[model samples]
Target: MSAGFSMHIFFTRFPLESQFGGAEVQTLSLMEGLKERGHHVAFLGSCPVLLEKCFALSVPYFDLNIGPPPVTKWHAISFLWRQFLMRKKLINAINEQPVTRNEQRVIFMLSLSEKLLLTTWAAQNKIPVFWIEHDSIGRWLRWNPWLPKLRRLSRLATTVAVSDMSKRMYLDLGWNPENTVVIPNGIDLRKFYKRQKILRSTTFHIGCVARLSPEKGVDILIKAVKNIPNIHLTIVGTGRDENCIRKLLEQSTLETHSNDEGQVYHLSPTTSVTILPSVPDIVSFYHSLDLFILPSRDHDPCPLAPIEAMACGIPTIMTDACGTAQYVENGKEAIVVPAGNTEVLHEAIKQTTLRTYEAASVQNTFSFERMIDRYELLFAHSAKL
Candidate 1:
């Protein structure tokens, strides 16, 4: 079906400007694609960062004035009160839109609370809703006791999982398999593609682009590459664990310095490590790397980093915990290893350094065009129902 429908996307977490993760990228790409197809896209959320991005994209949006969810009990009560007020605003915003008989109006939500609130409203109003699931099950929605009761209302909406593994996970969490569909995350080929291969450097450069969190296994990567000769690791992105990572690297350097008793040190450290904040020019970052690794300790559902790196003609190493591992073959497009196993990760990096292979292309499976097409079809189908 062609895409000339009106889609209202509800995502109230980190804004596209402040936190550009896989989910944020997907949302922006999807909205842009739908707009290109002559669809009207609107974002309904309270993230100032996202509002700025929406303004840049020229997409109409409504600000719910909500921030991150609360932590304390008193704050939780205040948050729920704000949500109640936001729901009224949401309903008013939806009612204000001019109703067109020819165009389909649908709600697409990324956050669990927003999905529940909006989907319940949509069900009562006979509007279609699409819930995009980006992670594995056991998230806030599934764990909430109200989920079972909400399932009836959720029947009016469709659940979209970003990967097949995620789809199974949702089903295991009691989502109707028939209502859940697998649609892997996609990347814009224009942003990530193979450049002319550069001359090999004397030192092998390994890179990782992920948040410095425990689940991301950046610490494990640090341990794996410690004291290794002629290898450099560059980590891009920061999180709560940044301090811990810095301490770990400091300890490694201390150990290395103490171990150098009679040996002469070279100008460059045998194992070099650099931690950087997120950059806008990620394509250039991938190009500078000889190899990319995503050593996630959790089940990373359809991570975009590895695919982006592969699209840039860089060989990547991923853990089995990544859902994208199902799409890539070991020793081919990527090297798959056990998550959080520093020894295995270390060995994989060493082995990959000695091996030479052609750059793999993910255009067929993970291209943005393919992803948008699937979403268009789903949106069209949902509108019909």
Candidate 2:
């Protein structure tokens, strides 16, 4: 399905993050594809990292500068006042450069607050609200209850989930089945293609790209790595658990060494682990890995890193609990294992041989073009309503 008419799409995020994740990557991809297709697209965001990204891509964006989340009752009132001011500013910003009457307007948001806050204004202007939810249920966001009911009362025109597993989770959380739909996170295969490994390291190499948060299970992966006798593990990305991961490394019998590739810690003569906060060239990281793994213990709604690795024809291992599990077949695209199982993870890591994967099939299945097409259809339908 495709939108026959051009749209003026406004993408949004609330409680924005400093470190980029799959959602940010997917948003940029959608914006790029839509811009290429001649749609007028803009980002309404506060995050510095994302705003700079929009600037680099030459995509227009409006910054509704944000403040910290409230930690107390009085702070909550202050936060609400700040949001009120932001909403007023947001309204004025949109009014200044309004879309042409012919192009349909769509507010594509990533949070429930966007819908609840903008409902009356959106309805008055004939702009349909589309919630593209990325987080799974039972995350830190669900700490409260009364606000969820309010969000339901202000139910959006459409809700887009990143995977079937994600869709199901929201369905249980009282999302309208008629309005909810699934769109798997997509990748640009040209950027993440397979390459021949020219240089080789003697040790078996395993790599994982994830935020070092509790839900991501980086600690579990570390425990599994400790058991493996002969291995080299590279953990990429940064989050709250950096110091904890370092401590885990130090507490173990691993020997630390300073290197050009950042810090390298050796568990033994046959085992070494390198932890890099960020990689300058990500495609090179994928190409360098012998095996890629996403050991998410609780929930992950269709992450793009493993898909990028699969696009590079690397054998993958991911837990069954995450939304990314639905995309790959067992022993084919990736090795699907039970979540948080150290022994199983250790056993899976033991099989160091790469599998025969058809990267072309992965490219065809999860291309950003197809993802945009699905979104176009969804937006087109909302416009018709």
Candidate 3:
């Protein structure tokens, strides 16, 4: 359970500095877990929120001088060309802390470009790098000339998929099957458990926590609940579709309010919905929900929200495309519905209201400890420690 010797871990794209979501939370959990076990953990990216967090935790952070990825596909060629200099800046940053003979250096990347760009640097230094890909790389890069070389370089490090679905996706894209692994994301069960004396609110409360993108299928959930009487819908997230969702809400309901906490709608005193762009903490929110739904319409690599909710013992309804669907048994830990089927989803919402679905101690398979153990074993073997 211990590294015996300190392993220096530099992780990239610390969320909130650039963006935030499930992968960011999982990365943070991994850093905290490794730090607790006496490993030397440091952040390798920066943003305002990340800086504040790093300072508060006394965790050192270094910015990767690699500029942001292309905002448009036409710019991708230029971005790839600039990675040559970016790689040099990163290597210089990594070398600032001299490595001892006994010290093992690890780079944990959660982004495709970071993995591809750092491969050569890691191979030259003989460091073990891991890229736990949480999203699929867009197909626009498939035809790019730089990708062939990058893919070859990518072979130098391990590619960790967050779920079997992601593993299959990677294999389909010609990733080396031998070097890839599937590690399901997990949460702290102790922190996400249900409250004592479970009680439902006067109105049926259904919840979802995900980025408000079209692929997330939040609109489907809203549509599903639109006709349901005396129910409350709560969504917690922020993304490109925030304005679109707000407009949809304004058209779908009677009363609406927006603030720093996000938006609120009152269909009536007994029927309402609330949307919070973000929350500092979500344990209480999960505990308060009678049902949790993940209505993703696309290949969701691995979502931590429903896992946290399932850990808290909330009834869960998820679409088939969600990566975590493989972990939970249908009709047991959670109910699985086809993605984008508003009729079926709405019916599920109506039928599952006030009912409780147990996770059947899914923590045994997806606990943070279990996830940390798998990661440690991978590193131990890779580091030859």
What would the per-residue lDDT of candidate 2 be over residues 270-310, giving only the tens digit for each residue?
A: 78888898898998888887888899998788888888888
True-vs-predicted CA distance for residue 266, candidate 1, Å? 12
- TM-score for model 2? 0.92
- Candidate 3 lDDT, tens digit per residue, 283-349? 8888778889999998898898888888877889999898899888888789999998999998888
Tens-digit lDDT string for candidate 1 (325-367): 8888788778899988999998888878534334444767888
Using TM-score as the measure, which candidate wins? 2
Q: Which RMSD values do the candidates have, in order?
A: 4.7, 2.4, 2.6
TM-score of 3: 0.91
Residue-pair clashes per prediction, in order, are 0, 0, 0
**Lowest lDDT block of 10, candidate 3:** 12-21
lDDT of candidate model 3 versus the reference: 0.77
Alpha-carbon local distance difference test for all models:
0.73, 0.77, 0.77
Model 3 residue 346 CA deviation (Å) reads 0.7
> Which candidate leads the pack in lDDT?
3
Model 1 earns a TM-score of 0.87
Task: Order the candidates by TM-score, highest first.
Answer: 2, 3, 1
